[model samples]
Target: MYSKVVMDHFKTPRNVGEMKDADGMGEVGNPVCGDMMNIYIKVEDDHIKDISFLTFGCGAAIAVSSMLTDIAKGKTIEEAKKITNKSVAEALEGLPKNKLHCSNLGADALQLAIKDYEDRKAGKVRPPARPEDRHEHTHGESCKCPYCNGDVNAGLEFCSHCGKEMNDSH
Candidate 1:
């Protein structure tokens, strides 16, 4: 069952539209669940001046996206980048076990949006759409440890560089 906060957010999602003049945008999808999310952000003086999203997903996914924008807006870029899947889920007072993945979609989309904003500010070319293209490692081959951003081999239980347990949350 969904939490009251979840239901409230789903019934009246916030920042629920696209921004044509957004400074950065990110899109992500979960093929298995058929959930897709697009996050748009506008920055000023290194802060998230505005944020919005368009989510094609279940109620939980919609709620997560709504909460994510609320959490990110007005925060500095560095602060917003720290918003994680666990944080979003906690903000909603927690989601059903089966719907936990929805939080990941929201956080990942936000991270990608922030990265796009940074890249644009640095005058760097946008990376390709593929996950592997955005990351240094090949998809399913390896990934950066969420704790330390160290290269971690796929399927590892703990990050070799950070020694942190890799749980379902990460």
Candidate 2:
């Protein structure tokens, strides 16, 4: 029941591996659901020369990771950081409602990778202690409302702080 794009990515996922000398790296996870993804990037002169991903997850996770790498490559670090879950899902045509979280996994992975690269350039942070990576954070943390930075509980009807109606499908 997978979409055509998802099927294609699953069949021949692109940029699926590690970059031993990656300029940056990022990982994200939904430990409760056991989906984890690590993304790596290679940079040259502030431009993304390559992007790759390794995922311990399902079909959707693989597809999202592949799509994310493809989209992030050739983009500058700043440009890559702007990539979002909505854009990843759009690039894949569409994912099943339940699989939307996979897109978040991809976005987070990219953001982490970009952050790593930036940190390296600025000498602000170091790489992982181990190459065995996973998603950086767990679930139940991203459902917050952006407008007011308020805690939006799962399945809430409105933003408790801003009185804004929450989209049913978000």
Candidate 3:
């Protein structure tokens, strides 16, 4: 079950591809984790001139990426940085309570891209390495689903409680 806005974005997401000429880029999580997002930004004079994203995730992640770019485009860096998980969830008219953390990444991804741009400008740091991708994790009986935080079989591919796919990231 999803809101119309959520479904609309999931069915036809905006800003869904990579921007090779981007001024900055940010990535969240590893592919082995099974829900990763990358954000690219082209900024001009402290304003966000353009934005795009590549999200290898579920419907909620796609919608969050689309809505995030829509909100950040044309805003000043300071303004865009203020965009948060709570605000993006609200922009979607709200996500299922269990899916709220899915919204936490939009602004974080953007802010990291901005920080990367700044770091590059100062030559103080190279873009950070992506987190190490690890898998074959064996969860204990107490482990919970990363998506819904619901109880799940440690070996299951899908959460019995939420129907969300289970991954090493969980």
Tens-digit lDDT track for model 2 on 13-73? 9998888999888878845466889999999988899889999899999999999899888
Over the stretch 9-109, how does candidate 1's per-residue lDDT look in tens digits? 99999998999999999898744346889999999999999999999899999999999999999999999989999999999999999999899999999
| Model 3 per-residue lDDT tens digits across residues 32-113 | 5456788999989989999999998778888999999999999998898899988888889889876776787666788888
Clashing residue pairs, backbone N/CA/C < 3 A, model 3: none
Off by over 4 Å in 3: 127-170
| TM-scores vs. true structure, each candidate | 0.74, 0.73, 0.76
Pull out the clashing pairs in model 1: none
* C-alpha RMSD of candidate 1: 8.9
lDDT preference between candidates 1 and 2, better one:
1
The alpha-carbon lDDT assigned to residue 144 of candidate 3 equals 81
TM-score of 1: 0.74
Q: Given candidate 2, what's the lDDT at residue 98?
A: 91
Q: Which ten contiguous residues of candidate 1 have the minimum total lDDT?
A: 131-140
Estimate every model's Cα lDDT from 0 to 1: 0.90, 0.85, 0.82
- What is residue 3's positional error in candidate 2, in angstroms? 0.9
